[model samples]
Each structure stands twice: as structure tokens, then as C-alpha cells.
Target: MLMELIFNLGLLLIIVILLILLSWVWPPDSPWAPRWRTKKETARAAFKLARLGKKDTVYELGSGEAIALMVAASEFKAKGVGIEIEPFRFFLSKITVWRKGLNKEIKFVRGNFYKEDLSGATVLYLYLVPQTLNRLIPKFRKELKKGTRIVSYKYEISLPLEKEDKKNELRLYII
Candidate 1:
């Protein structure tokens, strides 16, 4: 009985390690490859720059691991929708949110952010490249409501800059 228990424990450890390894490796081969999730401190600073509040619903593009959304929900008490194209990453995001008891505040959609309807979002948080940001400008202009806020990490969006946290490499804009 003791040997069987040890084997089962070892099997569980192996499975946990496998999941961790898979989570660290980029699963997508497209432009979203080498997923760079915004660091926790950086995400907090970006959300603060955007002035995210409890009433806001922040939508994140290429939300690998949904780190920003998790921070927004847990730290700022805001709701969020994470758009992740990779299925494995999306699954991990869902699990993370669930484990953190933020499932009620965060939702994950395994789809292209460009194709998703972001009309309901009051704030947009993205850490995409400049080219992708430029491509999404048209969609942002069309779907996002007037006075909508945006918090971009590293790259600046085309919208008028409202605030900037240069130390954190974050930019805020209003649509």
C-alpha cells in the first residue's frame, strides 16, 4: 500500500511539472508566439495609469496567462475578458482565474482578439507590437465607445495619449 501511494504521488508530481513546462513554452506559432506576459508590477502600474476602476470592464488582447486580467480583478476589483488564441494558454488562464477565485471577475475567450466584439469593454489593456496596435486602431475606433480608456504596455497606441508611466513602459489613451 505504501509503495502504491508513493508511485501515485510521484505520478502527480510529474503531471504538475509537465503542466508547468507546457505553460512556460509558447504554444502558438503565429505572430503571438514567444508570449510575453506583462509582469505583475508592470500590469499594476498600467492599470493604475489607465485609472481602471471597479465599474470598468477591461479587455485584454493576446492575454497569455491572463496576468493583467488577474491583477485587474484581484487588485482593482475590475472585471475582464482575456482574448487568447492558443487553446492551451486559454485553458491555463481559465484555471488560474478559477484557482485564484477570480472566475467571477475574469473570463477567457479562446479566439482572435481582432474577431472578438469588444463593444462592452470600458477599458482595453494590451501588450502587443506597434504593427498589431496599428491594425487594431480601426477596430478600436469602431467598436470602443467614446471616452473608452486604453492601457498599452511597451508600445504606444494611435489614440491620443492620456497618461504615461515611462518607468513601467506603459501608455494610456482614450477613444
Candidate 2:
């Protein structure tokens, strides 16, 4: 029994090490955008542009640490979903949501945001770079319904803007 226990522990340790290494190496081929935490001011601007309501479901792509998700849920009283590719940030955000008692309002999923279905989202929030935005335009066009709001910080989407906040550098588009 002692020998079996030792062997099991050694195998567990090796599995843990492999997982750690895999987590550290960002998937280059995947549409895994870099981590960019949106500032409170910027998040507020995007939320305002979205005009969120109780019925609204806000989905934040590349939601690093879920700062924007927290703001949307707490301030705007909207249901928020955050998708993060990075394992560390995903766990951190999940813990934060639980600690804040915002788990009812906010959800953090550890997966590629590109594969997530955006059809149900009333407001789509993004802080992605120009390349990612361009790449996602077709997906957005295919998935989003009419009157759905899209708020992008820093990088602009190829679509015509419904409203632009020059101060915060945010662009709002309606699908």
C-alpha cells in the first residue's frame, strides 16, 4: 500500500507539472487574444454606450480578470458572461465572482472566446486588438441579431459606428 501511494503521488506530480507548462504556453494558432484588462473608466464608458438594462446579457470577450464583467453586473444590473483563454485569469475571475457574491450575475468560462455563441448576448464588449476585431467581424455579422449592441474599446470594428466616444476611444455599433 505504501509503494502504491508513492507511485500515485509521483504520477500526480508529473500530470500537474505538464498542465502548468501547457497553461504557460499561449496557443498561437487559436484566436487567443492577449490579456488586456479594461480600466474602470473605459469599462464605464462602454457600459454607458451599451445602455444596459436588467434584461441585458453582456458578454465580454477576452475577459482578463473580469473587471468589465464585474462592473457590468454591479453597476448596470445586467447579467454578464466572461470568456477567458488563460487558465490563471479564468480561475482568478471565478474566485472573485464568488467572493463578491456576484456569481448570480456574472459567470467566467475558461475557453476560447472565439468559439462562444454570441447570439444570446444583448451587449458584446471587447478590448481586442485591431486584427482580432477584423477577424471576428464575419462571425459577429453571422451571429448577432438586429438591435444587439457592440462596444469595443481602443480598437475599432470595421462596421460603421452608431456612437463614438472620442475621450475614451470607444466605438459603439448596433447589429
Candidate 3:
């Protein structure tokens, strides 16, 4: 009985340590973390609100799993670029896009969203924390061309609001 108890304790300790390490590298609550997935329904709503359509270049900042980009490419007939900083998420998104045979329509970029050029983007889709949104204010001003459509899920941008989907909790702005 004592041996079994000790083995159980050791197993529990190992699991706890592993969890700590995982959380340290992938903190779910961190503003910069890219684990949160914007649902497909939400993506569709946001894309529709943004008026995304054929030939439109959409950039999804912190695009987890690249689901939004896939939706844009498949449903809205738009081209997309998904930027992800997290290594594992980036790899997963890259492979997923390739496996889904969307390499022609969607591109997965592994880098900082701020560093990625926005000049070519006609639309922006963001599902990020408020802190990240706040930090991007200047980047948006500097990089995004006038008339670029921005759709932010669950957070408001400082730009003038052009449209909103209250049910989906999304906001849209033009730069």
C-alpha cells in the first residue's frame, strides 16, 4: 500500500512540474499568447462585416490555428496571411493550412505581427487581448493604408467605428 502511495505521489509531482513548464512557455492569460481560437461562426460574422470578398488580402494577427484565414479563403473567396509568434501554434497552423490544401489561398507567417508589413493588406482580422490591441494603435497608423478594413473580435479599437456585430461581439474600423 505504501509503495503504491509513493508511486502515485511521484506521478502527480511529475505531472505538476510538466504543467508548470508548459504554462511558463504558453501562458493562456498573457496578452501576447496566441492560444485563443476565434470560432468559425465568429470568423464568418467578422469577415462578412468587414466586407471581405474576392481578391481581398486579409491579414489575421495572432492567427491561432489559422481557422479565420481558412474561412476567408474557402468561404469568402479572399486571400489571407496568418501571422503567429508562438512556435508550436505557428507550426500547427502552417501544417494545417498545407494539409487543407489552402497553400494557394492562405499563407502562414511565423513572426511578430508588428513586424509583418501591412501595406499590402486590404483587411485585418484580430482576435487579441486588449493590451496587444492598444500596442498596435501606432503600428496601424504607421503601416495600414487608408481604407483598410479592420475587424476586431471581443475588443474595441481606438479608430472610428464603422460597423459592429453586437451578437458576435465584433467591431469594425477603417484606416
Candidate 4:
């Protein structure tokens, strides 16, 4: 019994170490990866853009771990959809939404955001690099309905005619 216990403990320790190493080495390639932990002000700004009426449907592109989506779903009482490419983050988001009892209000999609339809969304949130935004500009213009609100963190795209709101560490645009 003692030998078995020692072996189990040793295996657990090794697994923990490996997980830590992997987390550091293979950090998620999120545009807001460094800011995985949401700040109060950022969350407030995102919520503001959501304008979250009960009828509003909000979509978050590249929603790493779905933290922002969870908050939006709970605070605004709006339906939230999140698309995440990373499998690990996707699973984590699924668990979080389930544990928060937000499964009904929050949905997590494990796939690329560019392929998803945005016509149904009234509000959109993104924290992606400038290049990614440029690539998605055409898609947004084509799919998003007029007057749909878009809130981007730390980056902005060149749109022909769009409104911009510049707050500390954030930017908002309406299309």
C-alpha cells in the first residue's frame, strides 16, 4: 500500500509539472492572450457596447476561455455566443459556462470565427490584431446588419465611415 501511494503521488507531481511547462511554452495565441484576466474598466466598456437588451444577441470572436462572454451573459442578461479556436480554451470555456449555469444564455463554438455568420448578432466583441481585423473587414461589412455595434480592444480597422470611441486601453466602433 505504501509503495502504491508513493507511485501515485510521484505520478501526480510529474503531471502537474508537465502541465505548468506546457502552459508557459505553448501559450495560447490570443490577441488578448496577455490580458486573459479581464479588467473592470474593460469589462465595463464591453458591457456598454453590448447595450444589452434582453433581445440583443452578442457574439465574441476568438473568445479565449469565454470569460468575457460569461460576464456579458450574467450582467446584461443577454444571449452570448463565443467562438474559440484553441481546443483547451474551448473546453475550459464550456466548463465555465456550465458551472455558472449560463449554458442557456451562453454558447461556445469550437471553430474559426471567420466562417461563422454574424447577421444574427446585434453586438460583436473582438480582441484581435490589426491584420486579423483587416482580413475580417469585408466579412463584417457583408454579414453584419446596419447599425450593429462592434467593440474592439487595442486595435481598430480602417472603415469608410464608422464611429469610434477611444477610452483608456480600448476602442469601440459602430457599423
Candidate 5:
């Protein structure tokens, strides 16, 4: 009994150590980076962009947990596509969308958002880092149609023709 207990404890300790290492190495690739919780003000701002019109299709980059996407689908009746890089978070987001019965209006894709096409989107929502946003702006300018709206939390693009509106922790850009 003593030998068995020691073996079980050692296995449990190994598992715990592995999990901790994975958590550090694979920390969710969310644009929010250090922060995972979505502030109410930021969510509201993203919702406002989605609520622009019923005909709008919104693409949320690095959509961790799909909170904003679910909200957009539920409240504005907008179609939402979310891209997430982390496997665990993407699975959690998928489960949430399924449980919420938003499968029809909201879809979550597990991959890098930078590689995905955003041309079909009428509105784009981002909570990514400045470097990511900088890399995406050129693509947005090239592919996004005129009048396309982008809502970003805590970052802005220095486009020559983009309009900026600051409210709370969010920024709105219209191309």
C-alpha cells in the first residue's frame, strides 16, 4: 500500500508539472495577450460595430472564448466568424457557441487569423497586439471594401484616410 501510494503521487506530480509547462509554453495566443477577461466597455464597443446593420458580417480576430461573437449573434442578429489560435481556448469557444445555440450565426475557426481572408467581412473586431495590427493593416487596406468598419481595443492603425473615434478603452476605425 505504501509503494502504490508513492507511485500514484509521483505520477500526479509529473502530470501537474507537465500541465504547468504547457501553460507557460502555450499560453493562449490571444491578442489580449496578458489579459483574458473582456471588459464590459470593450465588449460594448465591439457590439456597437456589429450592430451597425443587420446585414453586416463581422470577423473577430483572436476571438478568445467567443464572448463578443456570441453577443453579436445574440443581440444584433449578426453573423460572426471568430478565429482563435489556441487549441484549448478554441475548443472552449466552440462548446460555448454550441451550448448557446449560436452555431447558425457564429462560427469559430481554430487557426491564425493573419492567414485567413477577411474580405467577406463588413466589420472587423480586434483585440490583438500592436505588432499584429501593424501587419494586418496593409491587408485590410488591400482587401477590405470602402466603408468597412474596424473596432480595435487599445490599439490604432496609422492609416492616412482612416477615421478614428475613441470611447473608453476601445477605438473605432472606418476605412
Candidate 6:
């Protein structure tokens, strides 16, 4: 019984250590939005909103699993780049994109997207929270070229809306 108790205590200690590490890397309630997986339907709506095409370049900030990037690359033939902060999500997305034979079409970078340059993007896709969107207002205004499309799911930006999909709860803006 003493040995079993010791084993359990060790296991608990390991779990606690892991939690601490994760919290340090990805703080809960961060200004950056939490991971929210984009559904296929919502991704499709975003694609349509952006009017994506083969020549278009789509950048997804905080792309959790790169689902939206996959859709854009596969269906629209657009070049897709995803910026993911968490290591697990970044690795997972890279593997998934490669497995889908979209290595040439899609790229995944593990880094803070706020620090990356977004000037090359023709369309920017986001599923981030409203707080994050609010914070990105200046970034969008500065980096995005004239008439660049911005598609967001479940949150609206203060910028003038070019289009809105009420059914899927998404908004599109032009810069």
C-alpha cells in the first residue's frame, strides 16, 4: 500500500509539472485568442468572403490546426500560410498539411504572429476573439495593402464591413 501511494504521488507531481510548463508557454486568458477550431462550413464561408483564387495568398493568424489553411490551399488553390504560437498545434498543423499533399501550397510557422510581417497577404483569415481583433486594428491598417480582404468568424472588427454572412456568423472587410 505504501508503494502504491508513492507511485500515485509521483504521477501527480509529473502532471503538476507539465501543467506549470504549459501555463508558462501558453497563458490562459491571454490577449491572443484561445484555440478555436474552424468548422468546414465556416471555412468555406470565409473562403467565399475572401473571393480566394489561385493567385491569392491567404494568411491565417493563430491557426490552431490549419484547417482553414488546408481548405484554402486545396479548394481555392491559394497559397496558405499559418502562424501558430503553441508548439503542439504548430507541429500538428505542419504534419497535417504535409499528409494532405499540400506542402507546396501551405506553410506553417511556429511563432507569435503579431511579430510577423503580413504585408504579402492578399487575404487574412481569423477566428480569434473580439479582444484580439480589437488589438489587431492598427496592425491591419498598417500592413494590409489597399483592397486586401479580411475574413473573420464569430467576431466583428470596427472597420467597415464589406460583407457579412449572417447564416454562418462571419464578416469580411476590405483594407
How do the candidates rank by TM-score, highest first? 6, 3, 1, 2, 5, 4
> How high a TM-score does candidate 2 get?
0.80
Q: Model 2 segments beyond 4 Å from truth?
A: 1-35
Candidate 3 residue-wise lDDT at 144: 90
Return the top candidate by TM-score: 6
Pairs that collide, model 6? none
Q: Which residue pairs clash within candidate 2?
A: none
Candidate 5 per-residue C-alpha lDDT over 45-105 given as tens digits, one digit per residue, 9 for 90 to 100: 6667435557888898888887877767777788999988878778888998999899999
Tens-digit lDDT string for candidate 4 (9-115): 99999998876666654423453243354554676677775465677788988888777777677777788899888787788889988998999998888888988
In model 3, which runs have C-alpha deviations exceeding 4 angstroms?
1-35
Per-residue lDDT over 100-136 for candidate 1, one digit per residue giving the tens place of the 0 to 100 score: 9999999888999889999999999888878889999
Q: Which ten contiguous residues of candidate 2 have the minimum total lDDT?
A: 27-36
- The TM-score that candidate 3 achieves is 0.84
Cα-based lDDT at residue 138, candidate 1: 96
Candidate 3 clash total? 0
The per-model lDDT (C-alpha) reads 0.86, 0.84, 0.86, 0.76, 0.75, 0.86
Error (Å) of candidate 3 at residue 97 is: 1.0
- Per-residue lDDT for 62-119 in model 6, tens only? 8888899999999999999998888877888899888889999998778988899999
Model 3 vs truth, CA RMSD: 4.1
**Cα error of candidate 6 at position 64, Å:** 0.7
Please provide, for model 3 over 31-67, each residue's C-alpha lDDT reduced to its tens digit, 9 standing for 90 to 100: 3344457889999999999989997999988877889
Cα deviation of 142 in candidate 6 (Å)?
A: 1.0
